[model samples]
Target chain A: MALSHDEVLHLAKLSKLTLSSEEVLHFADQLTPVVDYFRELNEIDTSNVPETSQTTGLVDVLRTDEVDASWVLSQEEALSQALKTHNGYFVVPAIFTRTS
Target chain B: MNIPLSISEVQNDLVQKKYSCVNLVEHYLSEINTQNKTLNAFLTVTDEYAYTKAKELDRVITDNPHAIKEFPLLGMVVSIKDIYLTKGIRTTAASKVLESFVPQYSSTVVERLESAGAIIIGKTNCDAWAHGASGENSDFGATKNPWNTEFVPGGSSSGSAVSVASGLSFASMGTDTGGSIRLPASFTNVVGFKPTYGVVPRYGVISMASSLDSMGHFTKTVEDSEKIFAVTRGVDGRDSTVVNHSYKAVSPTQKFRIGMPKEYFAKGLSPEIEQKVRAAAQEFEKMGIELVEVSLPHTKYAISVYYIVQPAEVSSNLGRFDGIRFGNNRDSFGEEAKRRIMLGTYVLSSGYYDAYYGKAMKVRSLVIKDFDDAFSSVDAILAPVSPSLPFKIGEKSDDPLQMYLADIYTVAANLAGIPGLALPAGFSESGLPIGFQLLGKRFSEPTLFELGKKYQAVTDWHTKKPS
Candidate 1:
């Protein structure tokens, strides 16, 4: 099924992406056939088949809840790559802003 | 003196005092400086880092000749795909989002390789976020196929394959979530081995599809690939999916039976590729091995299931790159990356989750079962790596579906979580490289390597240069 422009825009919003009007049309045209192609899976009968989310058979692999020094990233190092940082904390766009 | 072709040769020359490790590094560095403009294989060249390591290695070679034995990859020049995080080095994943992002820590693969004395020459280019089957999806620039610069190098491990094919590095590390490693290897005429899922830890490598991604590498020879695998494989206590197990080494003299899956040779495969791959299989029969015709009934559904399951996971993994902590804002994402993110969001959304992601998982189980049933009858499966030889640049880039089809023969191995080794089969009439892969049971990497070595023993295909 062809995705409508609005549907494509909805997906873009959910994905946190701001697509251009041209991109919305382009993606709608590009993704429609791919989504339609996914219909091929419906041809197979999978009534009783269990989902295989992970192929590794390991389950409930537990480790002690302790810090591992080797894997740790210091606060300074973690904030080094952020575009905005203040007092060793990552700064993100404000979620709530008061009106004047 | 001529450049060494394999790891053993590089070490032998070092031991013989034919050339210092610094000389070797300089040679590869000079090659990159000259050829990278045309090939666009490397996104970043670590000239200073490589020179420092080479100088240190040169000291060890002079002071304690026997100490060189301890370092398995001593003096070996290698490259990492831009997707892996290398501490203090810029890792872009070939996308503008992470254009100047310098990782604070290195991947487990990088640390392990360095500890074993491998000198990382640079980070190679690939499809942004490891999304496409052709190199054209890279945000930096498409990596040119060394054999014919006009043709595309199969990707998302595009530049890793090009580096090995063009002699920029002895071996290059790449991640294969679908056909990333094998397709590029096939297009560029190198040996690319994708180990069984969870065999290699994905500690700091950029996640594409967490469950499906397998860390692999490209090398000029199967033996060299095995050496790299030895250092890189095993559980690192970081990635929970990594299994702690040992692969039984296959005796070189042991006889074997290989299966040729009937579905893989079905319509749409180029007749020339079929003939060449079939002829390569016959070389094993001449070695007194048996070949059986097997069937994977769920084969046709692999690509469709992959598109669904992979994107679902990609949507989840990419959620971390929201520009809050690391990479640039979502606006910097390339077109292919945006398309995948949007497609994934649509599939995993509330109303469609069951129909897309949930149903795709059930089909994935069927794909796994197909491999289980087939492996029971034969020790391994042999198939063409790609349906056709490398196409020209811009040939299939316009149509995403056509680009996805380039991985038709390869995605099944990733879906099944089996180990696959793609090695040179022969060259097409137009001189493009053709390759075939050997698929084995989970953690059967040793057997696959042994088979690859056996095939390489009789055929000179892997030895042919891109000239």
Candidate 2:
């Protein structure tokens, strides 16, 4: 499936990336052949094989029973990592300048 | 003895207090200071902690020497792959995206190795996110081969293998999804071991193809690899993929049976490498081992199957790497990574998932069945780790398809979830190292180690200097 320009933009947003218009066009070209290679996987036959949820033929990985505790970091500590924070959380520019 | 600088010579020195743990730490760190610039093997060097730990160990040795005796890796230095979490230290996976990120916890393997008495030298470089077989894919500058200045040290475990090969550290931890460990080891004339799938825990490791990603080791010798595995193998509650199986402790039986796959011996294999592999086979025969020709009828399609399955997993595994989680912003991520993500996404998307990921998984089953059949009649399978000797750095770097095929010989083991060991075969006439591997049954590493140690004992292939 050739990636649509809008789909690429959506994926980039989902991936937390912001691509310029020219860069998007260039990336679209580079992503074309790679997508074509994966398209070949559609020809494979998996009907007889059990769906592999995970390798190691394993299921039901249980979490550790032991509970460990750690010193808590305050909101001040959490917000220390950001260049901009509002209240106690990191803040970023709106996804869009304004809602239409 | 200067406290026995190399791992092979250090057991006795460490056993006695003549060299003291403090002295050995200083010795290796000093060597690294002078030698690391030329090798470019480490991304960080943990000198302060190493010295402090060494001094503390000295007090422990004085108070209770017996306690320290249980530790086999005492006073050893280990270089960690950048992908594993090393709480408080950066773990970037060679991508620009997580430059400032540090994990809140340590990886299980790192904790185990530290408890075993090995001091971490620092995190090392890899192909970005363990994506490629060559270190060139790194967001960090490429790691040059230690042997020759102009060649690449294979990747995505590039710095790890180069560190051990050039003696920047005693050994290094590397992850192998598809020849990432062995490819670089072969290039540098070191021993790179991929434990049987599920043998080592992968929790806290930056996952790459969760089904195939294996936490492995890079060492200067096969014996050292055995020691590393003995300490690192076990069940971890963190990685659900880890198997509960333990390898047989015994070595190969008398009249060992080794098989060569006809598929791996076909065209595109260099005449020199073919000759080297043949000689190595003959040497095994001289050791009273049996060499038989085997057919893995499905081998021809192993690469095709691997590309489909791996990229499909890459699509899912890498979904978290949007600019927010890890990895660079769209612009900072290298071209190769973007290419893989796009390809993977396309294959797993609607109308294509069944065709690609589904078919690849089916073919994977056939490949595993092929190994099961072959191993029933043979002790282990031997083949060239790579079809050709190391090529010049830029020769195949630009050609993605040709570069992907470089892993053709090594990917089957990953596809089948088996263990493979890459050891130096011989050198090309041009002085580059060539390597061959012995693929063993799941959890049958002792067999490969025994064979590798014996071969290394007779030939100095493992000892030759690139210079």
Candidate 1 per-residue lDDT, tens place, B1-467, comes to 36767888888889898998899889999989889999999999999999999999888878886755788999989999999999999999999999999999999999999999999999999999999988899999999999999999899999999999999998999999998999999998999999999989999999999889999999989999999999999989888899878677888677799999999999999999999999999999999999999999998899988898888889888878889899899889999988888888988999999999899999999999999999998999999999988999999887888787787888888988999999999999999999999999898888899889989999988888887
Candidate 2 clashes between residue pairs 3 or more apart in a chain or in different chains: A41-B355, A41-B356, A42-B355, A42-B356, A44-B359, A45-B359, B97-B327
Q: B117-219, model 2: which lDDT tens digit per residue?
A: 7878788888888878778888777887877868888888999988877777778999999899989999888899998888799988988888888889988
What is the Å distance of residue B185 in model 2 from its true position? Answer: 0.5
How many clashes in each structure?
0, 7
Which portions of model 2 miss their true places by more than 4 Å? A1-54, A64-66, A70-100, B1-8, B251-253, B322-331
Report how far off residue B338 is in candidate 2 (Å).
Answer: 1.3
Question: What is candidate 2's lDDT per residue for A8-86, written digit by digit as tens?
Answer: 7765564445677875776676565545654443454556766443447766768757754553445665554455667
**Candidate 1 DockQ vs. native:** 0.85
DockQ list for all candidates: 0.85, 0.32
Worst 10 residues of 1 chain B by lDDT: B60-69
DockQ for candidate 2, please give it. 0.32
